[model samples]
Target: MDLHQLTIHQARDLLRKKEISSVELTKAVLARIESVENRVKAVVTLSAERALEDAGKADKALASGENGYLRGIPCLIKDNMCTRGLRTTCSSKMLENFIPPYNATVVEKLEARGMVLLGKTNMDEFAMGSSTENSAFFPTHNPWDIERVPGGSSGGSAAAVAADEAIYTLGSDTGGSIRQPAGFCNVVGLKPTYGRVSRFGLVAFASSLDQIGPLTKDVRDCALVLNAIAGYDPRDSTSVDCPVPDYTQALVPDLKGLRLGVPKEYFVEGMQTEIRDSIHAAIKKLEELGAEIDWDVSLPSTRFALSVYYIIAPSEASANLARYDGVKYGFSYENASSIWDALEKTRQFGFGPEVKRRIMLGTYALSAGYYDAYYLKAQKVRTLIRREFDEAFKKYDALITPTSPTVPFKIGEKADDPMQMYLSDVCTLPVNIAGIPGLSVPAGLPGGLPAGMQILGKHFSEETLLRIGYAYEQATEWHRQKPPLN
Candidate 1:
């Protein structure tokens, strides 16, 4: 068997038995990346030297009878995340050459656990788009179909795992960045509650909505990565103080008598027939597993989640991205007559079209004349969305929906139509607005493309989410299918 294709749990077991050293496992993943990354463009930067160095240390520690669960496992970090001395371009011309001086809190925690850093993966510029097409550099091609996208802004990370370039990867989800890409790439992805993972070194998009999580081949690996990264950090005031649970220990597949809520608003008109049919089939499978499906529960605010997310996310983005002016940092214009002109010219030339549009819209919303009308109204709507999820969770163990309204579209299908592109995230935006935990697991491929089934739980209910996903994965062979990379 290819060692790179093994799950994190399996790799760790082999490492503990001295069947494989961390260095050997890291080399297997690196070799896979060398063979496939050029065609897929899944990795933007490769860190072979550092990865082997880290793996050597992990091997030494193990030989001395010291071990950690993730010690020596190869993993990729999304380019949006800052890694000291590594080029962390959130796939934008603005930060194309910028390197951070410190590691993100999550990076620090992962390193402390001995996970090997494979490389950085591509993403949408400032993580603003639903498709990887918005990346300023290059769009990551889906491993399953080279003609289609891998989804975004976490597309590269998903493609990397699906292509067997890495055992797992970390991704940030503001709206559906993690779940949508996972769905498209046929992997497991989790978006933890807001503040569940510290955001100290993440380049900001929407402060309130943005969250960091994991994408992997299965639920067990997802839980392993989450256990290392989720915790409070004093660097971020918004970080929550909840105790981290033993997520990996809760992978029970039996959902006997568990209440599963099916929201009515999610299955409305405009949804693609293939995706809708796939979700209905998944619901029936859950019912067969002893899960009771409830049909009347609804999230009335679901209809407004996309609108509210657009306004609030961009509004916060405008303020956060203000630091990128020519004077302070990143891709400044050379030899301008005046400082003001330099700042203006730098921003105009550095940011991509989609990024510039969001920055302008956010600036207008927060401007003196429209703050109360646009920004405040969005917040009020956000509260309604959160309350709806809270009420539904009171009676249901989890909620089910299609991760995206359709399978991955052609690379440029909706590139010119911003509204049509935004609609792709309609089923996913509500989870971010509500700050609850959500998981996207591969349902099956319909029409020759992959579709994902989203499982949502109440705040801090990641344990339940994994248990449900693992059960479904055990029952179906969908996730076992590989992309035809050769």
Candidate 2:
């Protein structure tokens, strides 16, 4: 395998055995980026020089007998997270030149482990769109087929991994941003329970729904990355101060006694037949591994997830994004005739169409006369959705569904139709609404396009989800199949 294609554990083993230097591995990855980045366009900022320097330091530490699972590994992250001295544009012109003064909590933890940072990946502007097409710079293409989107707003993160641009990448999921893209690109993506990971440095899209997780080559790598980043942070008020288990321990190859449920609602009438068939195959495979399959389960309130998510997420986004005024550190319109005009022009020109649309939707939802009708009602229904999941968990260990209703679509397939684009995440937004954990793993290739099996669990049940994902990954050859990059 190419050095860039090595999984985290594979690289760790080689690095420990002194068979490959960190510099060699880092260079291989950088070279891979140089070769295919033009075709994939998954990267936003490339920190080649700094990454090499960090790799050199890691090599010296290894020579001195120091050890760490990720010490010499290099990776990329979605551009939305704060990285000190590095541009974190979130694929938006508003913060095109913005450099954070301090690192996000997760970045700090990775740095502490001596992990090399390859740089930042692209995303939907302010993470508002389902396709990376909404990026202010360029759309990220799927490695499987360049004409198709990789999925978003974490498209670049998943695409980079799919294209072997990085060993693994970090992506934030609000409404299927990570999982949908992972499904499209054929990777392992997990959205941990809302408070399981710290959000101190994540640029907020929807504060209550956003959670950062890993996009990896396989389920084991997902667990390894999660072990490194999942923990409580006093810096984030919403962060839960719970103990984070070593996720690697949950990688048992059997589902022996677990009860995995399949909600019928997820198998919608109009979903692509390929996805529906692939998920059924995954169910059969899990059953072979000894998992008790509850083939007919109900989470009826899930039908309203897209609606509730649209209202609640945008409402939170409107408030969270208000900080990007012209007067602050972001883009400023120097020629504006007045303060309000400057603010208006700065945002007007800085944000993309999707961002503006969501902001308007959110603002309207929270407006004086509409609050009780739209925002309040959505929150109330959000409770109903969560309650339904809560009730389901009482009878089952985990829930299963397709990560998305369809495979990767053409770059502009749904770009002009907002509702069609919104429907892309129908299988996933409910997890965010319920604030639980969800894992997306490659199940099969339908029409030569990837389909993901999403495993959902109760809050803080990431270990169970990881266990389930790992078992599925081991039993199937799907994750082992790399994209053809056609």
On lDDT, the leading prediction is 2
Model 2 Cα lDDT, one tens digit per residue, 316-378: 999998998977688888799988998899989988899999999999999999999999999
The most accurate candidate by TM-score is 2
What is residue 464's positional error in candidate 2, in angstroms? Answer: 0.8
For candidate 2, what is the lDDT? 0.94
Full-model lDDT for every candidate: 0.92, 0.94
**TM-score for each model:** 0.98, 0.99
Candidate 2, TM-score vs. the true structure? 0.99
Stretches off by above 4 angstroms in model 1 are none
RMSD of each: 1.0, 0.8
The residue-by-residue lDDT of candidate 1 on 84-144, one tens digit each, is 9989989999999988999999999998988799889999889989888888899999998
